[model samples]
Target chain A: MRLAEAWRVALDALRANRLRSMLTMLGVIIGVAAVVALVAIGTGTKQQIENQVEGLGSNLLLVVPGRIQAGSAPTSSPLTLDDIDAINRVVGDRSRVAVTIASGETVRAGSRTGFASMQGVLETTPTVFVRNLDRGSYLTRTDVSTGRRVAVLGAGLARTLFADRDPIGRQITIGGVRFRVIGVFEPLGQSLGVDRDGEVHVPVTAAQRLLGTERIDGIAIRAPDRDRIGDLSTAVVAALTDRHPDTDFSAVTQEQILGVLGDILGVLTGVLAAIAGISLLVGGVGVSNIMLVSVRERTKEIGLRKAVGARPRDIGLQFLLEAVLLTTTGGILGMLLGGGTALLVDRLSPVPAALTWWSMALAFGVSAAVGIIFGVVPAQRAGRLDPVVALRTE
Target chain B: MTAAIVADDVSRTYQLDGVSVPALRGVSLTVDPGDYVAIVGTSGSGKSTLMHLLGGLDRPTGGTLLIGGRDVSTLSPDEMAALRNTTIGFVFQSFHLLARTTAQDNVGLPLVYRGVGRRERRERAATMLERVGLAHRITHRPNQMSGGEQQRVAIARALVTGPSVLLADEPTGNLDSATGQSVLALLESLVDDGVAVVLVTHDRDVAARARRQIVMKDGLISETR
Candidate 1:
């Protein structure tokens, strides 16, 4: 028989029992939907993390003090400004490298008070850290040299302290010292577990004096190009070790952190996808069960067709087409439902959930394969039915 | 031309729970084109078994059965199916019309298995329904029509493929006496049109309508008149 006729016959049979067909398709729908939704969430989170990592300035390295060993006594030695200068000297021309330091503190403005992070930076901090000002101006070389008491508020901090009012020129107290807000930083959103929009920036000298410390917390260095970041990191470590032999500090390149994070997230995504695949297997078994019942119920119909000169292959093909149609249709409906859910998640939460073409294709391919794999036994049973016995059944 | 149907010492045995029971005991018969033959017997006398074998619905365990001169036992399953499609047609006691399907589509079913295109299949089905005097009821489903009308649709479906012989097992068993007479008259007309007809039944009055009558007793042919 022609394929079109077989398709028509299958359609008629399904339509005759609409409720049963829909019930049989429910398993496939849930299976495909779960796979698509979970995979979309996984891929979306990976992309979000990659974008945040890339948002940090290119060709950058961080230097921080190492913890004391278990048996060793605590050391009061911390990285200082002199260490930054010595690293610059060892890394070649000063123009090709720059460094900034930061410390966490609480700041208050009149009736409003909140915990905030404070950064002690040089004139080139904005360029090296890829920060931009929303209004007013960045600190200059004289601000650090003269120890000026000027500060820049991050966007979130400004909003919390002043509401909708402009924060430039307003006075804010940090660690019990009053300073004028010279500028407000543009919105940067969250990155690397730090809220970039909720920080306060001041000159290194003013921060050192106000916080009662000449020791720096940590240093961020920018290389002239990506290719030179490795060499610059090695040089920074050598210079810091030479300057403070008794102090333990570590310098880490950006790629090392990204590589570790990618590995962890990749495993997490794989586990989630595997869990979703289990539901698809269950759905395939449901399809097989329903197909077997349909074959049993249609035995007389099979006999009638056989008597009318239909070959065994034709009977098998008709049933197989019915099974495939059920699954592929369910798969399409599931995709729509999953895509809608992902869009809703992206809107309602900070985590992004995006559906990709390849994931959709994979879900569809798996559904079709599931249909064929589960459909074969029932179709063969219908084909191998004894016509005489089947006709005698009714 | 060769006979439309030739059965030479054909036998069929059924195994029920591993116990062998013979259904047809080496019965031989020949039917020619344009012949209206009826096989009459009581229940369990193997009349239905012989009809099934003649229609290629089953294979005899011993001896040979041929339809349109093609040996049935030698033909593969696929070839037997093709032979049934081209040479023989069947009408059943239950009228076997698919419920919820229009008469036109039900009549076109045999041609569908023959791979006929959609438009031609419909045209041939319509023509056959017209010949069976059900032209106006082509769009009606089986349940929408009377028992006699449904049987007419089955007859139309049987004749749509233009086969050489028609095998009908109790074709008028479910109809009233008046309706059964009309159906037998239609089959008589078909035999007059040069298509051989084989009718199986237990009703002596029904068998009396045919030109030849064969009687069966305990899986063996007892008489022919």
Candidate 2:
């Protein structure tokens, strides 16, 4: 049969049964919508996790001091200035690698007292890790070298110590030694589950003096060449081993963290996509049911067309196209709904929702395939009907 | 000359509920161009069976059947479909003007199978409808028209294909006397135009209108008068 005529015949038949056709298309629509929505939510949550991880800084690596086993004095071989100096020298291109060292100490400001993480670092430490300083100058390299009593306080520390008062330049006592307030770091919300802007910064020598311990317990490192993270880690580990043979330490790479995160996202996407696939099967079954009903309804028409010289293949194609067109149209609408939903989520939530272009194509392709697959039984039924008996049927 | 239609020693049987009820047995007949032949029979006389075989709607279980100079006794289903489309036109008793389709589109149907362009096919269908005095009803659906009008539309549809022969199986079976006579007159006129016409009917008056009449009984032509 000619293409236009076949299409006309199919459309006329569908129009003859309007309610049935719409009901049939509804299955496809719901299937498509479900697939899109499920995938979008799953992928959106994954993106949120990635951003939360990334907020810790792309290059920053954390190292915690190994504590002495059982009741023994806290590892005397703590991360020291010598170890920090060795790490800095090993990755000497300052543009690429940076380091921060910190220790825990009791700090007293006016009448308030708190156990604060007193970090000994350069001014650039705030910009690299914790960010957005609200008040004063950070402890610079010159301050570390000279053992100045100037301190840079965390937002939380400042709030606790001075309340609403200006505490910059005010003197705070640490371990019975008075230190002048220099700068305040802005509130960087939650790093590794702790509020970052809740700490304090002072010159390395001043921190050692105030604590009466020349020990550093924590160091955060940044490497220059991301691709050479393994080499950088090796260099740091070797340098640390050489300086303090008995001091056990460990080094980690952000690339490894990123990989673990990627694997999680990939698994999540796969699981969500599989769940969405169930809808396609349901949609296909729906098409088959609809097609079967259509065949039964149009029995006389099929016979008439056959009597008028319609080939079996022509009859089959018309029914197949109907199903394909219905499913594909549903897929397109579902994709639009999915995209809009993702955009809405992105707008409403702190997490980002991304709708990749491939996702649209994937959705559409699945829908078309669904139509073809599900429409087969009906097409075959229509094709196989004997015209003589069909015409005689009431 | 090759007969317009020929059935040599034809036979057909139906397997109904696992039992064979023979519809045709060792029947043979020929129709030539411009011959207005009518087959008369009561129910179960196999007149409908003979029509189906002659029109190539069903193949004979035995013997040769030729239509438009081609032996279609062993033709594929698709080949038979093509033969039916191009060589013969059927005028069913019920008018069979497809429900919900415009008269023009129904008439233009053969051209669609023949792959004619849309515009020209519609024009030809219009001309055919006009020939049947139904030019005004070109866009009317079958259900929207009267019995005679619907039969006229059916006639227009059959004539639009310009086939070698026109076969009418009880063409007047569903119409009133006036409508049936008009439809018969239309069929007789096609004979005037040199198109062979074979009509099947039980009506004696309808049979008498044809140039020749064949009486069928028990799956065979009992007499020709």
Candidate 3:
């Protein structure tokens, strides 16, 4: 049969049953669209998290006490000031390092009292810590070396402790011990699971004297040069292992953490995609059923074509083309709809959903495969029809 | 003399509810080229069955059935279709033109299978329409034409391939007397053109015009003249 005539026959069959065609297409549409939308959303959330983490200088590594992996973890370690000093001395000049100790403390100034993260940190913390501040001075090397109990309030902490007052130079009681307020930080949003703009800062020595623990809970570090971050990371690990060889403690890089995060997102995308792939299988079933029904409905037509010299392959081509056309059309529509939905969510909310070109290509290719797979049996049945019996059928 | 269509002891049987029903039993016949042959019988007397077997729509269960010197009963389904397309044309009792296709497209269907070019289809389908006296109904679908017009379109499609033989099952069975005679005149005209024609009919008047006639009864040939 001529290709044109085969298409004409296919189109005629599709047109003959409008409701069935539409219903059949629904399966493919929903299936492809779900795959596109869900994968985009999953990958988008992952991208957003990585962005937020990188904003805090992706080269920055966190050394929290104990071993902890996010989403699934055990409690952090009891890292202390001595450990921080040791790491700093070894990784000195190779990476920027900061030692920090944190305790929940209540600050009182003139009748206002507020809860804050009383972080006793070295002066170098602000340099390697990568913060954006809105107001007064950060701590100086003078403050840490001198153990001067001077404090820098995060933007939120400043708001709470001083309200509308000029907070710098004023003294506030932390755990009832008075300390001079040196500065207030800028409003930094969520980063690395920490609220940067909502904490209070003090000198590391003072925190130990006040908390009566010489131990620090965390240390933040940044490789001095990004190009050598991996080398620097290896060096830091060797140094830390050398310092406390048998303690079972380890050094982690932000890049490694990001890789772990990406893997998690990949699994999430795959799982959601498989769930959506259920719809494609359903769509394939729809194509099979529709083509089968078309064969039955066009029995005489099949007979007539058989009588007229249509090869079995020719008959098969007609049915296969119809299925391919139907599914391909559905795939196109689904891509447009799914991409548009993702765009809409990205624009209207913080969904961060974005459709990639490959996603659309994947949808189309899968839909075509589905059509061929589903179209085969019905096309073969139509091809194998007996002309005489079909013509004589009422 | 060599025959255009010859069946030698051809037998065809069908399985119905597990019982083998013989529809054609050792039926043998011959038709010379350019002869108008009519097959006449009562309903279920195997005349339609004979027409079907001769047309290559069904294979004979036993013996040899030849069209233009080829044993059609031995051909594969696809090969038989090729034979039917190139060697024979068909017109059915019901004017079985596709319901929604224009008369021209219906006529062009055979040409499509024949792999004729677009220009050739246009020229040949139009000429066939003119031959059948339905030139004006070329663009009209089957439902838009009268029974007589529809039959003419069917005849045009059958003849468009220019086969040596035309097998028509009850060519004018659904038409009125005037329309039936006009269709029969068209069939007779094919005989004049030296294209052998086989007509299956219950009407004696329809059968009478054939240059030769065969009668079938109970799956066997009862008479030939």
Where model 1 places Cα greater than 4 Å from the true spot, the runs are: A65-78, A90-102, A209-214, A241-253
Chain B alone vs. reference chain B, TM-score for every model: 0.98, 0.97, 0.96
Question: Which of candidates 2 and 3 is the stronger one according to DockQ?
Answer: 3
Fnat, 2 decimals, each candidate: 0.57, 0.51, 0.62
* Candidates' C-alpha lDDT: 0.86, 0.79, 0.83
Best by DockQ: 1
Model 2 segments beyond 4 Å from truth? A11-18, A42-55, A58-78, A93-124, A141-218, A243-250
Q: How do the residues A223-251 of candidate 2 rate in per-residue lDDT, one tens digit apiece?
A: 55477667776777777877777777666
Per-residue lDDT value at B94 in model 3: 84
TM-score of 1: 0.92
DockQ of each: 0.68, 0.58, 0.66
Docking class of 2: medium
Query: Please, what are the lDDT tens digits per residue for candidate 3 over residues A1-394?
Result: 7788778788887887788888898899988998888878887888888887777675786665445655745444456656666677767751378877778888888898888888888888767867755667888877877788898888887888788988989999999898998788888866756777678889988888998887776677787666767676566666666666554454577777788988988899889888888988899899899899888988888778777767777888999999988899889888887888878888898678868777778887899899998998998898888888778877
Pairs of colliding residues, candidate 2: A132-A186, A133-A186, A136-A183, A136-A184, A137-A183
| Model 2 chain B worst lDDT run, 10 consecutive residues | B92-101
